[model samples]
Target: MTKISTFQVEDANTQIVDWLKIYAENAKVNGFVIGISGGVDSAVTSTLCAQTGLQVLCVEMPIHQAESHVTRGREHIDQLKIRYTNVNSIQADLTSVFDTFKSVVPHTSDILKVNLALANTRARLRMTTLYYFAGIQGLLVAGTGNKVEDFGVGFYTKYGDGGVDVSPIADLMKSEVFLLGKYLKVPESILTAAPTDGLFGDDRTDEDQLGASYDELEWAMLQDESKKSVEDFSGREKIVFEIYKRLNFVNRHKMIAIPVCKIKK
Candidate 1:
């Protein structure tokens, strides 16, 4: 497996923080509001926003979230509060909201599709909640997706986690996010925890769903940049390259802007 490249941690942190501050200032927004999942991406994003010294509201929207996920999320919030005077937090337990949503929707015979739709629903619900807070607080909704998830695999839900005013860490790969996480002194629990979206309300991890680890995906992404083909690889490398290509192709729509039909005079 190819090693993921690293960068100078201090420079990245300073650059991202500076960019975030300038963006918010130019937009005439008060600050940034982000959903704080227990994952490294959210943790790192929130920390970067907090470094801007703007009003960073870390929100926890739990729809039957796993215990570990909830705990780490709260832990990061607490740590950020102590470290940054601009940080604040609140929790919106959406378990009942989700249950009510399920009750109101009609059931279909496609169990697999139903399950997937429900998972995406959880993400959309959280997105709505984030926007609600943003509306009230005059804050921009900061997205937590990283480069691998946003561009490499298209693993996030469209109009769900994909919904954001700005994405601070979307350009960074998963391994790079972790590097910033360590530099920012993010809590060890979150740093050590397996990366899970917690949308399904179960213990399934991102790797479990994607069929390849982020490290492998990052390597595959680099290889794709070099125009390497699966035929050039063997065994595990071939398997991982194939997985990367499949996800990239299927979710290409998410990576690009929406298409509009042009009118003919």
Candidate 2:
């Protein structure tokens, strides 16, 4: 575990912004498109893209189950004053999409799959919407996954929230993202809000799903750099550890591009 220069907060922020600028220039993207989940990761990503002088198109696609996050999503966009569009993909659309799959195969006790499918559908739909506007507007799809989630546990859905042309904060750890948020001067309330997927019913958080809090995860990831031993193994910690071990396959199969097999003579 290599440690990024903790001394270079300003440098890191500048480098991130500059990298985004280069991508924007090379890709001929006049703006950036992001699915704003009102979560810290998306909030930080969207705000950074907006502040970098790109036309940030923030999309809020709240399912019927997550109608409550709608207001919070809108509030963040409103506060940012970036060009935002709210698109709702509620039960009607989700049910419509899943109808075909369910008809092909019988539903099972895998309620997790059912819930994840609904959630992932919303995310992918938002990505599709972003690309729709991006193509029309000559913009790039900016991904919002951070380092901790990207490396540790593969916490995102494949072809869902995982699609993007460029990720502005993929290198920043969870704690570093918070620091960047402060550097970007994101609103205090959003900065302090609990990180969540907003896919679950009610105000359930990502920490709730992962078992361990992001704060604890961040501490462990950072501290593990030295010859540090894990002191406690909570149920959540075990789950997260398993996810970390499994992320290689998750990313290789899901997030990565497919490899073509060639026949040799």
- Candidate number achieving the greatest lDDT relative to the actual structure: 1
RMSD of each: 1.4, 4.8
lDDT of each: 0.93, 0.68
In model 1, the clashing pairs are none
Error of 2 at 3 (Å): 9.5
Best by TM-score: 1
List, residue by residue over 6-74, the lDDT tens digit for candidate 2.
467678877877888877988776878788776678778887777578677777655554654566666
lDDT of 2: 0.68
The reply for model 2, stretches above 4 Å from the true place, is: 1-7, 65-68, 82-106, 219-243, 246-252, 255-259
